[model samples]
Target: MSPATCVFYGCRHPVERGMSKCSHHRNRAPCSALQCHNQAYARGRCVRHGARKKCPIPGCTSYRRASGLCLGHTATHSAQAKARHLNLPPSTQPNTTPPAATEAVDAEWVLGLEPMDFKLPPSPSWNALDSVDLAIIHILLQDTVA
Candidate 1:
C-alpha cells in the first residue's frame, strides 16, 4: 500500500506515523504576540518577545550579555568605570599624529634584478598518439585549415 501523504496544499511529504499533517504543517500553539506565527517558547510567547534579554543601554536594541550590556558597550563602559574607580583623569585630547605613509616599490626593478628562464617540456610526436587521439587531432587540423 502507498504511504499516507500530508493533506496540506502542495505538500507531498509523508504524514507523521499517526498524525494527519506532515511535521512541517503540524498544528502548533503560535506565539502570544499578535500577528506572529512562530511557535511559543515561554509564557505563550516566542523567544524574541518572552525570553530575550535586551541590552540595558538606552537607544540600543542589541541582545544583552552576562554583564547586562551589548558586546560593544560592555567594553566601553567597563573601561570607563575602571578608569573612574582608579581616579584617572578623563582624556580630552584627540589623536593628532598622522599615520606613516608607505612607499611603493617598482615591479620593474625586481624583474630586472633576476631574469626568469621558462622552458616548456618537449611535446610528444604524432607517432606516440593512439587512433582516437589521431582522429581528434585530424578533425582539429581540418577545422583550422578550412
Candidate 2:
C-alpha cells in the first residue's frame, strides 16, 4: 500500500516506502566514500570539503583538525598556538604557577620544631653572631688548678 523509496543521491529510502533509492538518481547515485559516509563526488570527496589532512605534531595524524598541533596537543598547544598565530599580546597568555619556595625556614617549620630552632625571634640581620655568644655560654668553665 505504501509508495516505493529510491536509493539514489539525496534519496531517503524508507522501509515503508519500499523505494530502492530516494528522489535523486537511484541507479546513477554512486556509493559513499569509505573514509566518510557522505556521497562520493570526486575521488571520495564531497563537493564542499575534501578529506582533511593529519596533524603535523611529532606523533599525531588524526586530521589537522585545528592548529598544526593534533588532538593530543589540542589541550596543550591549541590555545597557545591560536594566540600566537593571531599575533596577540603576550600579556594575554595564561600564567604558569610559580614553583613553591624551597627556603630553609619553610622546611624547618614543617618539622614542628620550637621557634628558637629556626633562630627564632629573628636574629639581628645587621649583626652576625660572632664567638661572643659562644664565650658567654661556656664562660670560665675551665679551672686554673694550682
Candidate 3:
C-alpha cells in the first residue's frame, strides 16, 4: 500500500510511512514511538504514547510541566519560593465580596439610556479600559439595576 499524501495544499509530496506531513511541510518533532505518525506532545513521544515525563516523586500521576516537579508540585513550590524570596509568609486572601449599599430606597428607580448614533464613549480614560468598555459597562449596570 502507498503511503498517505502530504496534508499541505498544492503539495503532492508522498509522506513517509510513519509521518503525517512531507519533509517540506513538517515542522514539529515526530513521535518517538515506533511506527507512530503523530506529532510529539511532550517529553519525546506522542501524547497517547506516554509523552509526559512523570514526576520523580512517587504517588504523583501528573506530568512534569515546569521546573523539576509535576504541575501540582510546581504551584506549592512557587508559593514557597515567593514567600522565601519576599521574606514574608503568604498573606491571607484579599477581600473579594463587593461592599453592600448603605442606603435603601422605598421606591423603585428606573435607569434610562440616551441613544448614541454609533460611537464609543468619551475618551482620555485609562489605556487598559477603552471608551468602548465604558459604553458596555453602562449597558451592564442598566441591566442589573432593572
Best candidate per lDDT, number?
1
Q: Per-residue lDDT for 61 in model 3?
A: 83
Q: Tens digits of per-residue lDDT for model 3 on 11-116? A: 5789866886788767767677777766677887777789868887779887777688876677566556545644664474222232134433212111123433
Per-residue lDDT for 56 in model 2?
A: 75
- In candidate 2, how many Å is residue 105 off? 34
> For model 3, what is the error of residue 75's alpha carbon versus the real structure, in angstroms, after optimal superposition?
1.2
How do the predictions measure up, each by TM-score? Answer: 0.36, 0.29, 0.36
Which candidate do you rate higher for TM-score, 1 or 2?
Answer: 1
> Please, what are the lDDT tens digits per residue for candidate 2 over residues 33-118?
54433465655565435545667776764666555645566655644654575577989864333213332333233344444434
* C-alpha lDDT of candidate 1 relative to the true structure: 0.64
What tens-digit string does per-residue lDDT give for candidate 1 at 1-146? 98888664345779898887688878745577877655666677778676567788899988888888888787677556545644667784222232123433333332444433543333443457799998999999999776
Order the candidates by TM-score, highest first: 1, 3, 2
Decoy 3 TM-score against native? 0.36
What are the lDDT figures for the candidates, one per model?
0.64, 0.50, 0.62
